[model samples]
Target: MRTATVSIGVSNRHVHLSPKHLEMLFGKDYSLAEVKDLGQPGQFAAQETVSLVGPKGIVEGVRVLGPIRKSTQVEISRTDSFRLGIKAPVKESGDLAGTPGCMLVGPAGTVSLSEGVIIAVRHIHMSPKEAKQLGYKDCDRVSVLVEGERELCFHSVIVRVHPDFRLEMHIDTDEANASMLATGDQVKILGRTQDALDLVG
Candidate 1:
């Protein structure tokens, strides 16, 4: 069986703003300032931060990821959703059709989104060559073996393949904490469903 080791990327709550929303939140024609580069190519953590206002409470200083997207999306953990009183569905990124929305407060203005909040599913980002080498394709779902004090297998991890993607598995803070995983930690890719079952057996 084809196997490979991938690095972990622990994702915290972040927001991806559309150009229009970016302008509204920051100012007209404003651009995001790159504070740090992320694992993925051409993605960075912006210097700006915003507060999310929900029915129950407010979460402040949520980092903004760059560059801008076609639509604004808010990615939070299930625990954060509970704290904010929003019933956000677990979905892949960019699948924000009927998810919950919240009030976003920025230094210049506020945006009341009608919909665009989700708890992002776990995924792995890899280049096409890497995916081929590991016998994986884009959109394929597989299980991963993480070793530590909280050793466990992560199932249904979606594979994302692109020319520019770096080899890294992205998991939310909740998942990371549950598995006692940190960024740069290594995990074993156990191929498809049956392969994972075989390993467990």
Candidate 2:
């Protein structure tokens, strides 16, 4: 079996704003203040925050991730979904069609979205060179083996390869807690889904 080690990035509930939405939420000509750079290139945690208001309740102080995207998106955990009474589907970034939307409250104003909320699917971000070295390609499903007291294999993890990406496996807070994983913790990619199917066949 082919195996490769990769670092983990545990993601918390956050929001990505589009240029238009950012202006609506923060005010015209406003820009995001970068507090910290993320594992992925050109991505950062902005100092600003916004409140997400749903049918049942409101989740406040949700950090905004930067730089701005073409469209705004909200990535929350399953627990967060229940608290907000939103049935957000597990989807890849930018795959927001037919998903739920909510009201975003900011200091300057508020924006009501038609659809843009999702529970981001766990995925690995790797550069093309790294992907080639790992024998994987973009959008490939693979299994990852975690080691520790709660050691287990994570299945159906999608691979995202790009020139600007750095090698890192991103999981939500819930998944990280279940496996007791932290940022920079190393995990092994066992093989692609086809490899497992071939073995079974």
Candidate 3:
């Protein structure tokens, strides 16, 4: 069977801010300065960054991505959570229920968030047309095979399809280092669940 391919994008720890939180963190009328465009349409990395304060330690210079979201969220790696002394769940982006909380230090002020930190789950961002071409739907889970010095198969990868998204697979820094994967590396989609295993086997 012909498999779908996606470019890998290793995402470092970043923050997505809500409108209210943005004002509270920055100034009353501050706007994010676009640094670079992301894989997804209209999404960019802002010049702004913030410091995250946790029980055990503080993580500084966490890049803030733009444009602003409806709800604020902090995406960290498993190792970051350990360093911060938070037990953040590996959750899909924007699903912040029952997650840990942390203080975000910005230029204007510091905001204490009740809950929003997460260790982002590995996911593929694709357009609706791309999803249809691959015979997949939003929320469908699949596995990815990355061939390299450290060949690895990533399982339970969530599919997120939207009109605005481009074809890309997002993984944390830790995962990328473990598999010797880097930006621009290609990964093959190996169907869902058992079929995925069969592909690897």
Candidate 4:
């Protein structure tokens, strides 16, 4: 099966902080310094990194992404979750309800979170125009076919459409390794949800 092709971007473990958490971890009046622009519009990787302390272990040098959000969230891979001994559910960004939490240690200070860690679900970010062209809508489920040395099909990929979004599929490190996919690689959209069948057909 073949359909539209989307560029792939491998996402590493990272944290997004709210202003208050940023202040508590970095320092009062501290602001994130952009290291580089990301594929998604307006989102960038900060020069700063922090250590995540979980019940079982600590993972260091986790990049911080900017700009700051309304709430702090940690996105890790399932392998990292096992290493840290946290059962982080696979969730979409900003869906932190009932998620796990961990302590974040920065240069100036350390902050403990009550809850907000997750194994980010695989998703595609695209603009409305691109979504319409591909016969996809926001929150629609789809599958993707990755071809090459490590061929595989990724299911339950969420479609996220926004005016500011660029057309790209985001997968965590583990998924990337399993499929031997890296940033700038392309994946073919195989199928979408049943309701959108006719549209893709």
Best candidate (score: lDDT)? 2
Higher-ranked by TM-score: 1 or 4:
1
Tell me the tens digit of each residue's lDDT in model 3 across 1-201.
348888999999999999999999999988999999987899999999999999999999999999999999999999999899999999999899999899999999989999999999999998998999898889988888888788878888999999999899999999999999888889899888568777558
lDDT digits (tens) for residues 1-201 of candidate 1: 387899999999999999999988999989999999999989999999999999998999999999999999999999999899999999999999989999999999999999999999999998988988888899999899998798999988999999989899999999999999999999998888666777768
* lDDT for each candidate structure: 0.94, 0.94, 0.92, 0.91
**Overall local distance difference test of candidate 1:** 0.94
Q: Residue 59: error of model 2 in Å?
A: 0.7
Q: Cα RMSDs of all predictions?
A: 1.2, 1.3, 1.4, 2.7
Total clashing pairs for each candidate: 0, 0, 0, 0
* Cα displacement (Å) at residue 50, model 3: 0.3
- After superposing all C-alphas onto the true structure, candidate 4 shows an RMSD in angstroms of 2.7
Show where candidate 1 strays beyond 4 Å.
198-201
- Each model's TM-score? 0.97, 0.97, 0.96, 0.94
For candidate 2, write residues 33-138 as lDDT tens digits.
9999999989999999999999999999999999999999999999999999999999999999999999999999999999999999999998999988888899
Q: After superposing candidate 2 on the true structure, give the runs of residues whose Cα lies further than 4 Å from its correct spot.
A: 197-201
